[model samples]
Target: MPIAATPLRVLQVTDLHLKTQPGSRVWGVDVDAGLSAVLARIRERHPVVDFILVTGDLVGDEPDAYERVRQALEPLGAPVHCLPGNHDFPAALGQRLRDGLVRWQRHVIVGNWQFVLLDSSFPGTPSGHLAPSELGLLDTALAMHPELHAMVCLHHNPIPTDTPWLDTMTVGNGEALFAVLDRYPQVRAVVWGHIHAEFSARRGDIHLLATPATCVQFKPGTAEPQVDELPPGYRWFELHPDGRLETGVERVEPARMPASARRAPT
Candidate 1:
């Protein structure tokens, strides 16, 4: 009998919020330091991933920081595919992250799995919206590769996170996105970032996942935005050839910080 194929290992790091200046703090946590710690853990725990997906928020509203974002991710030694979050400048990402291991790739096929990265960012606002063209891309990719299992990724949550403040920023036309996905049975999962907290749910047979930010986490189920004391982290996945997937979140202890750097909920 023939042996089964080895599962493909993939890493996802999102919501870096890196600024032009190093050591900047987001919500009292050092964003750069947090990302470095998460990357170190990734190197130790997932040293040989097939690729890395940075869902969005690579920089903190600073277009010039794309280069810094590129520098931070280069040492990982895997093809890094990135999409824009509300805080990102799309043009800058395309121009600065064009070469090397980092790229602005929308669709990727590996083994029997096809990854579709979408830009849910709407201009001049933090809320998410999928344009007609983006939906078209998904339709086209799924139609062309019916045999390949699909995992759709975006920076914004497609479902209500139950956090009232955060829900205002969820994908505005998420229903349309689901309507498209409903047509394809091969879509195994839909994953995203921007919530800064880990979320897991099931939509029929499809898996819905939201990963924590590498910088800081927001407390879930709160009326207002509140910071969670949970340490920074990333998500990992093992995609088997038969459409079976094993995934989990790994949080790392952030470097010790001065008391002044820690923020308290208002």
Candidate 2:
């Protein structure tokens, strides 16, 4: 692959967990407030973004809240691509988030990169499972775009976070996912949300990354769900045309979290 003059700059915001109500709380964190803070930080730090990738959980279980999500994201003035999380209603997302900057796009091609967003949200459960259709999508995308660097995006962590409680809900057939990617050398990274903490590892040459949620930070390596005092955050990626990439995470400043959300349950 030939390197382009400029790398594609992208922002990844995930697990928003927004609600229809103005001030909604999830696990003691005010989701709406957190999202607002995160977006503000993004606008301040990254003024020019090629596009935004929202991994999942755009809204809390409320189907009508997709409208709220669209309203919130449209002001950013950049194309927004999203996929559903376990807490989202897929049908509602497609129906309500069809216009403007927000869209439920499964595959996107930009510069020398191809982003394949998979839906791992299974009906009636928190766990994730990639149906054969999703795997086929991945396979087809990789086969069709052999020259472009590929990044696989989804809502659930395909690999374990080492947090036992969270691992139970990981992609049920992660081996199958890797099986497809292993065949393609152009695959650069596998990124996801839902663990609510930052995770980075390497499988062969592909980067395996799990980003922190925009609403809350979950304590990793815990036996059960626990909230951390770390502020809300998002991931940034600079994908080069030569198949090399640079990425990192940035959190909100001054730790504006409420006291109630700063501690783990006793």
Candidate 3:
């Protein structure tokens, strides 16, 4: 995991529903703890990562939650860029991440790859959308980097993940998103995080990925809302100088439990 020798490396974590404790009635219990564990693992394994993408769901719309999340991530020291998730307050989160965040407004070139983040979080809803204005920004970014390989990041999955219940709150303008991608064959991949399950697919030449949540993973294609009991995880990507993108998900072991609910070691 010596990323220093690599062209460019990025780590992404999403849907971290971090809360104060395990059983707190408050929205995001233990997501910060889970993220902390992931951060520790990442630092130990890949110390040379250039940047990280925490794609959204930073604080679950609570001012205190966002505050805690901010404090937790301040030590990582990477140039972290984030977008607003459905659970986040854009204005509030934007202010906190102003220095750390990058807008989806422009095409960011890292090595030979162009990274574009999409703010697909619609206000007051659990689903996502890319407004006309936002779409225009994305279109322009892709057009500007016609020859550069691109990756678009968003909070919600643009395509269905085969789970009927989880599919209810997907990106509203998926067809439009795809249409725009079709216009730009130079785009490399589309990465998303809302599904909370590890899945991947191909749309023509474009690779679509849905990464695991940092705390809990929702069972894939299940009718019941059950947890996978897997450890918090994140994804890493190595962008070669030749525009070839190599990425995979890494599930950290020994699920980090809150102090109040530690499981007994057998």
In terms of lDDT, which candidate is strongest? 1
Candidate 3 per-residue lDDT, tens place, 194-245, comes to 7777989998878899888777666678664545666778999887766677
lDDT of 2 at 87: 88
Lowest summed-lDDT stretch of 10 residues in model 2? 257-266
Candidate 2 lDDT tens digits, 1-266: 44457999999999988888988877777888888888998888888998999999998888889988888898988999999999899998988887668999999988889999999999988889999999999999999999889999999999998999888999999999999999999999999998888999999999999888888778889896677789889999999878898999998853444545433211
Encode model 1's per-residue lDDT on 1-266: one tens digit a residue.
23237888999999999999999887778899999999999999888988999999999888999989889999898999999999899888989988789988899888889999999998998999999999999999999989888999999999998999898899999999999999999999999999999999999989999998999788899897777788889999999988988899999996443434343211
Ranking by lDDT: 1, 2, 3
Please identify model 3 stretches exceeding 4 Å from their true place. 1-6, 19-29, 100-107, 256-266
By the TM-score metric, which is better: model 1 or model 3? 1
Model 2 misplaced stretches (Cα beyond 4 Å)? 1-4, 254-266
Error of 1 at 259 (Å): 10
Cα misplacement distance, residue 155 of candidate 1 (Å):
0.4
Q: Which stretches of candidate 1 lie over 4 Å from their true place?
A: 1-4, 255-266
lDDT of each: 0.89, 0.88, 0.72
Flag clash pairs in model 3. Answer: 18-28, 18-31, 18-32, 19-28, 19-29, 19-30, 19-31
